[model samples]
Target: MALALNDKVLTEVYGPSTGTALRIKQVAMVVLGIAVLAIAAKIKVPVPGSPVAMNMGTFAVLTIGAAYGPRLGLTTILGYMIVGMLGFDIFQSSTADLNGINYMMGSTGGYLVGYVLATLALGFAARAGWDRSMGKMALAMLLGNVIIYLPGVAWLGVLYGFDQPILQWGLTPFLIGDALKLALAALLLPAIWKLVGDARK
Candidate 1:
């Protein structure tokens, strides 16, 4: 069995560089994380027969959560949301007309909210040693991915209707994509850790 690595990927990758350098690195990581989330959100695929699109935002969320610890991960996600709310086209569901607070109150707002929860959930798990091995990382990613749909489906259902069809439209269509993303993230983290550890030695 592999021993648990440190929860924060930056700290692990860069060695124990201290003081202002570490703080700068952490701040840069948070900003980069937000940029990553935005980039992932932009990779949108229109799902046929559903209003909800398949996007890699959750995948990025999982990756960032696993890399950053809870506090930093949560802060990073919140920063992403704030950026979106401030009229940036950083959100996956961003529209030409509705870019600011309007988008938040729009249909995809709940999933937007769920992003924070997913980050916190996965962040906590990563910090607690779930990010070390493939099996545990996969489980943590799966849980994190699933929780995103709670608010997603709820908000979607409320905006549309409280019916099975609506639920299916909001969630069922994305399960396969989410599973693939989860598996990718699970494998990706371990691979990154292995590569980084080897490089440092």
Candidate 2:
């Protein structure tokens, strides 16, 4: 009975083969996922002069990573970047250009790259059979957020002398907001996973 139950679970988790139809569906889903992520980028919390502002994109990134697994998550973020580069006007404040490149290369660039890494890391964690519990999801998001900041701060130090006062604009104000965003991602991602699970069921 236990073996039979396990088989049933596996079958449910990994759907039966549908060949081309499945491929089409996957493509459609990826396109839709990109659109959703674009919308997420549009929803921003403005911060003055600081390129780092809070946005729902991270939550969408977490959701995409969990739902589509690592490769798709990475692809989706790449898609987002491409869209921005093409002047989609989806990025919160700046449109894609040389200035955009500068912004991407600036202190926030690390965080941007981190978004890709975070998605891949979190998606891989999920694929490795991490429990879809809220706690685990929160921890994953938290770690991902932190991973990006390392590069962000390092770049900031390189761009603007590290010896410069830390308070005026060196990761302090952003900390509270980032934590809040992480908390928001933690709260939302699990609910989204559950909904996706229910749809699969």
Top candidate by TM-score: 1
Candidate models: Cα lDDT each: 0.82, 0.64
Candidate 1 per-residue lDDT over residues 1-201, each given as its tens digit: 764544454344574458887788778888999999999999999988777789999899988887886888999999998888889988887877879899887777888888899999887787766776899999999888778888988888788788657767778889888889999999988877876775533
Off by over 4 Å in 1: 1-12, 15-17, 198-201
Question: What TM-score does model 1 achieve against the real structure?
Answer: 0.89
Query: Once model 2 is optimally superposed onto the true structure by TM-score, how far is the C-alpha of residue 148 displaced, in angstroms?
Result: 2.1
Task: State the displacement of the C-alpha of residue 161, model 2, in Å, after optimal TM-score superposition.
Answer: 2.7
RMSD to truth, every model? 3.1, 5.3
- How displaced is residue 41 in candidate 2, in Å? 2.2
lDDT of 1 at 90: 86
TM-score of each: 0.89, 0.74
Reference-based TM-score, model 2: 0.74
